[model samples]
Target: MSAWQDDATRDLMGLGGRLALLVRGEGSAVWDADGNRYLDFLGGIAVNSLGHAHPTFVNAVSQQAAVLSHVSNYFATPQQLELAATLKRLAGTGEAGRVFFANSGTEANETAVKLARLHGNKVGKKGLVSLNHAFHGRSMGALSLTPKPLYQDAFRPLLPDVTYIDNTLEALDELDWSDVAAIFIEPIQGEAGVVEHPAGFLRRARELATENNALLIVDEVQTGMGRTGDWFAFQREGIVPDAMTLAKGIAGGFPLGALVTFGEASELFYPGTHNSTFGGNPLATAVGLAVVAEVENNDLLANVVTRGEQLRAAVTDLPLVTGTSGKGLLIGIHLDGPHAGAVREAAHRRGLIVNAPTDDIIRIAPAYTIGDAEVEEFTRLFAAALADVNGTASEENNA
Candidate 1:
């Protein structure tokens, strides 16, 4: 057995086995402990926006660590305030918005739930609505909105009154808006194999939420930070959510999450109602500020569009691939058969890293900094991997 497998403290909580012992990373590639290099198409499951070991990110974190790392919520740091302002500006809520920081996406969603419940308590609306096959987080509150039974059935009795609706307008139209406290939706459902909300679905959701006097919360944990060719996925839809949860690429892989609320929802949480010790530490926020600056200065959002198009164009025509889905760098490949796992394993053997979110779906969330050369290399390796898997399957059938 491998050393990681033999470790006593390692829990096999559904992650079956260790894939590789990655020692270091740079740009869109990582090297395993065995000294093998692989192009990281998974991008840490859409976390490393600017790619690994970005000099700007490294310098920001280092400088902040050398200056001030943590100060708790009692005393606010300049970096924290600056990050809050920057996020508010990016969210397009301007000076009227407020931000609450957290350590991860789940915590951000937890905060959103609290804010929704607080708003609901005031207005006597206690129900919540979420789309089916949506993945917010693993926390009890976020899991309540998440519709997958496999993630929730084990932990029964989640937060009550959460209704899971389909992605269509008809499903949303059927909901009695009077009782709903909030409607939580992911602009692009990442964990559901990159499934996108149908056209005009978000706009209708906004209208419904407004009609019911409920909050509209967009969980942009995966789709935010230029993953969809925009700062936030909702921007393309041209509707602003009342509150949005952000993480993943927000800090360019730093452990940071934020809940940004617009309009009156910004004042929902009282001073003592919610708190996080390590939420907006100077080091993390300093890195966050740097990431934001990097995204703008380097024009990573435009890069996301270019690279996404190049990748989709390269792969969509492959014999094994049925089609490609998603915007920007958060892409998914639909296979003609249930061979995503086989293809992923084959790609790994060929020094390419990808994710099989399902038996038939392969997710590719490469870094925004991925260049045309890297995309071409990935396409070549991926096609070879598909051929290898297909050849193996054909031999098995003949045997």
Candidate 2:
């Protein structure tokens, strides 16, 4: 029997409700006790960039564990410094760069919010603006910025002073400038079905923030780390944010998150103002460095671009799929009907793992290392799933 099965059934309802039984996972596939294999296109919600049990990540973790793992905030490790320096190099240094490590994407967003608050108050600014349908995280601070009622209604009276604006350049027209401390936007809205910003929207956002003397913060938690065929999605837009929050792929599925800032904004948090005990531990940071090194060395970004194009091209003409959105491996399938959940379940039964962003949107976040065979299998299973869900064929067992 799978330990996760009983454990999950008994204690884990805080997350999404139970769907299938998972016995084990390896590489880009998982299995249930019933002996079903699923090609995992979801990639653990975009965290397993290198895929499950990648030798590189495992070896890096094991080697670092043997050397050293946790070193408290009172001390610094070479790995921590290396990871920070790598991020700075990737994001461009000489602009006064710094990093704060955390344990997850939510914490990363929390750290960014804290830094923005401190910086805003120091400059006598108040409040921040975030986009509608944006998802930073589930933590209180990050949640406060997320403008959805379902995710917010349960936790009322969140942190104050957040303005929700649709992603329209003109939306900033009437807002009070000085009171707005910063504007938080995701380069690609991941949870909101991968909705993309309008053309030149990021440029206009940068202009608005500059005109208001407010910072622009990009939440790249789901779009960073070569997920979008670029180091950061905002880079493709030719816009540099004041600060950026990252996680989900930093440590190749390990618990690692970082808040990176440049320019004078980096000086906002002094040593004692903000800290995390296990944030920059040598183990996670070492693995993070390894992950970054592998992505670059293996040319995974190029792979992402190529595979993403292949995937889009393959699925573009499907009958049930209205269109596709997103870049690189982070794809969102817009469906013609509200049967996405059914389609997801159908695909699961057909030996492919995918997810539904909502009732009519399917999200496909395959590993960067996924091969052509995996892509073809996903498309075939997805087509079958859509057919089954749409009642185009009689119900087929295990499909």
Candidate 3:
């Protein structure tokens, strides 16, 4: 391991140790201290929408920093307002929609949790619903919506009184809407091995939430910003969520997030209801605007669809590969055995970065700027990794 990796293991909190000590990156590749190049299929967990060191992102950061960086939320900046309008348009919120800025996706989801409370307060409801194995964020309120024991166990006595359900229409119908303030959906549960909901589940949830007067909040933090072949995965289902949370690729790897509310839900927050010191400041919003413009003008959505299809097709035939899940650049390769860990290590040895969210799933969320070269190279490295692991599955394995 490199010096940084040793320091990370000794000093970093929670993180056991570092993987490779990545020193620099450009496009879809990174280099470690030993000068070894690795194909970055993870893309900062879908944050590097434009890959690393893109001119647009760098320029935006530099220009905004040179001018003005941050001010209190008491004051609004041009970049902030423009980003709000852009998010409203992209999210189809129209005139009735409103935006709340934050510094991370968990903070955005926390805002959504509060919105659920505000909606439920008038109706005497104190319940929330989320799918099983969902990973919203690590904060208390957002952690409540995330129903994993591993994530919520130590932090027991979670708030929000959330009910966990499977990704089925029957499970959704079983939710006690009489006491439900909101139902949170991840659209595509990226953290849960790229699990996609059953067909039409989103639409049905929308109708049910409406009939029950519950807010339908989609956690688009992983699926939005054109990662799922569209601006948001809910659009593919043709459902208009009452609210949605965004981050992770919104600003091309910048630490920014947003909570967007629609219709009456937009009217929930008054002044002092919530605030963030570094939220929607000039620096973050300026970078976000640049990222959005690049994705839109270059038609990255189409590239996402095409490259995603290419990746799925290229890897589906590998040995020990059961199938794939997810859409667009966010994909999960399913394994027939509990050897995803072995395969991940093998991939890293071969200089291809991949993530295994479960024992049998390897998730890949590459940059939207990927071309045929990246797909082809990923297939070569990943196929070799699979073969190397399947031949000898007893090797020590970790991310």
Number of the top-ranking candidate, with lDDT as the measure: 3
lDDT per residue for candidate 1 within 301-348, as digits (tens), equals 999999999999999888689998899999999998889999999999
Candidate 1 stretches with Cα past 4 Å from truth are 8-16, 396-399
- Counting clashing residue pairs in each candidate, in order, gives 0, 0, 0
**Candidate 2 lDDT by residue in tens digits, 73-157:** 9999999998999998898745489988899999999998888799789878879889989999988999999988988999999
Candidate 3 overall lDDT versus native: 0.93
Compute each candidate's TM-score over C-alphas: 0.97, 0.95, 0.97
Candidate 3 lDDT, 1-399, residue by residue in tens: 657866776788863436777899999999998899999999998999999999999999999999999998889999999999999999899899999999999999999999999989967888999899898999999998888887889998889478999999998888778899899999999888999889889999999999998999999999998999999889999889989999999999899999999899999898888999999999999999999999999999999999999999998889989899999999999999888888999999999999899999999999999999999999999999998987676444431
Residue 216 error, candidate 2, Å: 0.6
Error of 1 at 254 (Å): 0.8
CA lDDT, every prediction? 0.92, 0.88, 0.93
Candidate 3: Cα lDDT at 295:
96
Error of 1 at 311 (Å): 0.3
